[model samples]
Target: MGENLHEIWLKDALVFLFAAGVLVPLMRRVGIPSVLGFLLAGLALGPFGMGALAERWPLLEHLTFADPVAAEPFAELGVLFLLFLLGTELSFEKLWSLRRMVFGAGGLQAMASVIAITAIVALVGAESHAALAIGLALALSSTAIVMQTLTEEKRAAGPVGRAALSVLLFQDMLVAPILILIGFLAQGQEANLFGALLEALVQGGVAVAVILLFGRFVLKDAFRMAARAGGRDFLMGLTLLVIVGGAVFTAAAGLSLALGAFLAGLLLGETEFKHQAEVDLEPFKGLLLGLFFMTVGIGLDLATIWSELGLVVAGLVMLLAVKAIIATVACRAFGVAAGHAIETAFLLAPASEFAFVVVTTATAVNVLDAPTATLVTGIAGLSMLLTPAMAHFGRRLAASVDKRAAGEAVAETFPDLRGHVVIAGFGRVGRTIARILDAEDADIVALERNPVIVARERKAGRKVYLGDASRPEILAQAGVAGASMFIVTVDDAKDAAAMVHAVRRMRSDLPVLARAQDAEHASLLYEAEAEFVIPDAVEAGLQLAGRALAEFGYSNEVLKDRIAVERSVEYQRAAAPPA
Candidate 1:
């Protein structure tokens, strides 16, 4: 029996690899998001799909997952990596800066969602406890799906992305208490709900304190020691250890494992090796996340949906509407723009993986019946399946709103502007340039795709506007024709190149400057008619070498001359075409 189980595992591994390696790439070529691709693949291969006929068509057995639960452990690791990577992108200081949105918007969104959902469920004839359980289960959004979507769309660092993340963070904090409440409901009137909740919160607080303390004290030193061990393998192993160790610790404390991983990432992000950690774990995160999506797909019961098609569809629609409306209002109250608030609402409207856990527990304790649990789980799964599409639509809708707003503001903006800098992309690099230019009191008009950034920067009294720079109309609107210089500081290589090309088409004599990730990207930007292309990697190397020379007591002038010579040589080499 053990051998048989091992064989089944091997087949399942093959199936997972097939989806990640083959199906995903094909989906990408057709412009489908990888998250959806994995879901469809999982649906096609799970027991309810191809595996249901394995006995009649034995060959199908090797191509499908016989048991959905088998992949749950690895699926969970995917969630850990997702949260950990997100944490690595943030610092405690940045998190603190978002405290208002996190606590205010996040708290309101959660509370409102639960109350609204519970009332609706009760109105539909569910018992009070059962309705409450359903509300708690379905109120939250899928962290994995939403984060992955934002990351894929390059909006993870923007206002909407950060806003979504803040709400999700608060939701993570609520998981333990929600579970406790469900347990209390199961225990009937004899159980002390407040006491159980308070106890869980206390335990959770202790667990967080311990994790933070260890991270603050030991995390940096451990990473430093690993780096000093003279091999990347050591660093990689240590990273995995930290992720898994933190995850296990939190799980033992009756909290979410992903929360522990997120804390570990937050600590590691504060260390110098944060970038290396991200680079090492990226491949692992992608594959594991794909598997996680597949597990969600597997949990989807098509038969149940088909049997109760009308009810399931109505429930899904109602879930999205209530959550989206509440989330939008909550975000809007916290200063998010109307367009971006709507986008965030759509991004977070879907039910999350947490619903399965809540419903399953409620069923086990007799608070919810098996059919109700299955239906809720199915709704959650189907909602996740729709997340990518919803997010895409939200972006488009937001862009439309932003374009109209920009048009209305255009006549009063950039009036008779000439010899001013026209900057594309309002990200970190673009903002840095804006700061330096602002110091010089240079005339500048910046165009950005993210309305949230535009709103925030405008509130800070900068001339940032919402418009995609890749379009000729946006460039014209930004006064690029009369600009002294056009700067393309966007992080996306393709977008940067496109912006340069668009500028060159309209203003052939305009001096265009662009940012590139590497020499290859520099060459591409140059080919796109950018007169000046700064390769980040090459410049970083030059700066580090110059700093090293200074540390070695070299004269400042000598270091300067040496770095200049190297820079010229590197740029010239990069400019040349392939041999």
Candidate 2:
């Protein structure tokens, strides 16, 4: 039995990886977002597809997902990583800055969505408790999809993205109470639901306080100790420990595991280790998040969807309409721009992965019947599957509005920047590059779209303009046409690629030294005509190897020559087709 389980796991991993490795790039190349690709992959792996075949076809047994339930853990981790990354982006200072949006827009969106959906469900003759459970489950948007999309598109740190995130954060925080409410609604359960709620509150509060205290004190020092040990493995293990430990702790408190992981990230974001931690966890986050989306696909039932087509269609349309209305108004009230509010609404209208957990748990607790739970879950799944397209349409619709509102129509001027360096994005990496160049008295012009960041940097006397780096008009305004060099330092791969192409078109001979996220991204940038690409992973590896070799008594010249040879070989290997 153990050997069979192991074989099944191995086979499933290979299939999932193969799908991601092939389908993701294809989707990305064709301008379809990864969220949809993952969903499609999951559908192919599900019982209605491959799993059904595995039962009858001997030849294809090893290529199918034998047990869909086994993928759930990986899917859950993907969500935890999303929350963790979200938490890391939010420092206490940033959180304080967005307090109004968090409490105001977030609060209103959740309440309004729940109330509107509940009323609609009740009007359809459902029980009040079941209606409430269904409403709560469907009201939430897919955080994993939305966050991944926003982050990849360079919108997560933008106003619309932040507003959407604030609402999602509130939804995450509400999971515990909803679970307790489900317990109360449970049919034949004599358990003291309110008592259990109180118990949860007490335990949760205690657990949170302990985690905060420990992270604020012991964890930082522990991270330092781990770093002092000078082993990436140790640091990586500690990172996993922190994230998983928080998840376990939160689950123990009757809250969703994602809540605790978010808390841990929030705490760790305050530490110096945040950047390295992010680097180490990023690959896992991407792969696991893809797996999470695929599991979402597995949850869907094609036959049920076909049989209840009208109900499914109606449920999805109603949910989207209600959520968009609620979220748009909420965002506006919280001071988001009109176009941004609409974009935020669309980005968050799809039902979340948590909806599955909610519906399943509710059915198990007798708060909802199995059929009702399954139907609602189906609605949630379909809504999620359509999210990428909805987001794309919303973004296009808002583009003109955002442009007119921001007034990019009028011609713009820049400081004397003929032969100056063009720095796109004013985030951490860009800032570091600016500092280095500034110390050497290298003239630089930076392009950034975040109004707040631009305003703050301008106040600090930096030559930063409020503009999207991917736009030709913006690039022209920033004097990229005659700039001596272009440094594409944007953290987003898609944006970086666009920036590279834009720069290459304007100045084919100019050196465009771009920061590639990883090897794959480096290849994309290279294809985009970037003059030089330095992948972050490759650079880090070189640095570590150089230091280790020097410590092992190699002469400076020998180390330099050896490292250069390694760099040359790596680039050559990268240029070669895979065997």
Candidate 3:
């Protein structure tokens, strides 16, 4: 039996590697996210896909997930690792900062989604208790898929991603209580909702407190000891022990293993080993997440979906639409911009991986029947299938909404601002520019999109305003008419070009100096009327070469002449915009 298990494991690993090795890269080359590739691979390889083929063709047995049940443990590990990686990116300070959004936007999003979905299901003839269970189940958006997809898009730190993470954190915390509530709902006349909630709160509190305390006291020392005792192998073993142990301990406390792992990761993030730990766990995380996605696809139950095709389609549509509207409304209520709010809503519209768990728990407790559970599970899987497509549409829609908002915005008043420099993007580059100009006593009005950063800079007595600089209204408010120069230090070259273009349109003679991400971007900025475009790579390379020349005992005059010649003859002429 052990040998058979090992043999099966070997075969499954090969299939997984095949997907990652061949399927994922092929998808990427065609402009598809790897998340979708994993999902599609799972669906095609699972019982509902090629597994169906294997039943007819014995030769195809090796190509499919012949036993998807065996994949669950690895899939669970995938989710835990993914959360742990996410936790490493976050610190407690960041978590505290996100508290308002977590409770305000996230809590409200879940509550509204549950209430709306329950009412709709009840109206559609489901029993009130069952509707409530199902509604709560469907309210959750997939943390794994959402995080994975957004991270792939390189937006994990962007506005929409941060907002989504806040809501996802709240949803993760709610999982334990919701499971308890499902149990209570199942009991019908004998159920004690308050009692269940109290117990859940107590258990959750104890688990969290224990994790926090141990993280503060024991975890670091243990890791330090392990590292000192051996090396990478020891460190990796310790890492696995902590991840798996945390999951076990919390699951024993009646919470999800993924939650425990996430908390463990959150604590570990504060330590010195955070980056190393992330690097060590990432390969495992990717494979496990792929397996988890495949397992979800395996649960699609094609027979049930095919038979109730109309009803299934209706369920999916209602599920995604209801969640999207509720989430969007909740986000808007919390002062999130229309574009970000709508984008977050669409990204989170799908049902979570935990929906199946909820249905299974509810059914086990007799709150819901087998048929209903099957239908909801199928719908949840189907909705997840739409995650990548929804994300693409959401991004385009968000850009449109933001562009419109920027165009319509009434610029904030900055009275008595004249002959100053307008620094468009108050990030690292913008901050440096402001400091240099301030040293020269050059009056400046810095415009930044992130309000938090603006507040921080403003607190430090810098001139910063919260607004997109691409808008003409914003440039005028920043004293563009009287300003000596326009400094477009925004990170994205496209944005820098827009800022340059906006300033040039208002004042054709204003010197537009911009930072470019690359040569191509520099050309674009030049085309947009930037008088001088600094390509980061070019300047960095020159600085490095100058330092190397100095180290090699080259004279200062020679270095200067070579640098000037290279700038004029080699790099700049190649990258320069047309005359």
lDDT (10s digit) by residue, model 3, range 411-511 = 54563467888888888888888777778988888887765576688799877776778878777777788888888887787777788888888999988
lDDT of 2: 0.83
lDDT of 1 by residue, 84-104 (tens): 999999999998999999899
lDDT of 2 by residue, 283-335 (tens): 99999999999988988887788888999899999999889889999998877
Q: Pick out the ten consecutive residues of candidate 3 with the lowest summed lDDT.
A: 406-415
What's the distance in Å from true for residue 287, model 1? Answer: 2.0
What residue pairs clash in candidate 1, if any at all? Answer: none
Where does candidate 3 stray beyond 4 Å? 1-6, 410-418, 441-483, 498-507, 527-529, 545-579
Sorted on TM-score, highest at the top, how do the candidates line up? 3, 1, 2
User: What does candidate 1 score on TM?
Assistant: 0.83
Candidate 1 vs candidate 3, TM-score winner: 3
Candidate 3 residue 80 Cα shift, in angstroms, is: 0.9
The CA lDDT of each predicted structure is 0.89, 0.83, 0.85
Q: Give the TM-score of each candidate.
A: 0.83, 0.72, 0.90
| Top candidate by lDDT | 1
Local lDDT at 471 for model 1: 76
The prediction achieving the highest TM-score against the true structure is 3
